[model samples]
Target: MTTNAPRHIISLLMENEAGALSRVAGLFSARGYNIESLTVAATEDPTLSRMTIVTSGSEAVIEQIIKQLNKLIDVVKVLDLNDGKFIERELMLVKVKATGAFREEMKRMCDIFRGRIIDVADGSFTIELTGSGTKLDAFIESLDKAAILETVRTGASGIGRGDRILKV
Candidate 1:
């Protein structure tokens, strides 16, 4: 309920079929647990999909969530990335005002964040950046709040580092 609650990144493998995602999401909603972010995509296995769910709760709460997820009919496997060493990333596309004096400053800010100006318009520039959620947030914070026009973020996706792998 609060930001101080420990955040958890739960990765799950499930059947790549209609309603699988809905069921997963529904479970969280039904339990009144808020999902901070969720990213789902078909994995290399045609029959399976990988879903990364970001949520915050106490250790007990996270344990309960994982147990409930494992009981789902569609879920094949589940792993909490926080349980071990892992790498996480999120993608953000931000459109900012790029006119007059703002243009140079915006470009400089983007370069500092290692972001790419993927699109340019008469008065706006769209930037693409990839990194951990904190990094993305820092990039946004570095900008003038009024300069931000629109932003889209792909929720955090993560995997265990090294030999740790979640496979069917």
Candidate 2:
């Protein structure tokens, strides 16, 4: 990761309808920008959706991205979490080989990371963990690479800290 190129967590409140997500994604694709991770779901207001996008770029580039996002018709509100104190988290479900001795080791690893063993089968265990991206990455790194069978992650979801709230 390049420290000079800052990573930004952008949150958006938009119309919950078809093409809304496409337009948001298209804006980045058309400009040749890459989205590191994205997660979207309907908000408390069924008519609105909340989207969290993680991207990295220079200061000017991040400003441009925010500007462009604000111009979209379906976008009701846009917030750059990095602009203020915020809390960010991600959830990951990983399946690892757990046969024989590996089972005991994997269980110990999950306990050490405070991860929950959500599922178990004859040869594997599925664990659920939630935390900052770095902590999640570290947990994965701590395990043997070959022991990992599959993984799924919910991209970063963030909200402003303290009394700051983004609302239309």
Q: Which candidate is the best by TM-score?
A: 1
Estimate, for each residue in 1-168, the C-alpha lDDT of model 2 and write its tens digit.
254588999999999999999999999999866699999999888999999999998888888899999999999999999999999999999999999999999999999999999999999999999998988999999999999999999989999999879877
CA shift of 74, model 1, Å: 0.6
Point to the candidate with the largest lDDT.
1
lDDT of 1 by residue, 62-164 (tens): 9999999999999999999999999999999999999999999999999989999999999999999999999999998888899999999999999999999
Model 2 CA RMSD to the hidden true structure, in angstroms: 1.6
Clashing pairs in 1: none
lDDT of each: 0.96, 0.93
How much lDDT does candidate 2 score?
0.93
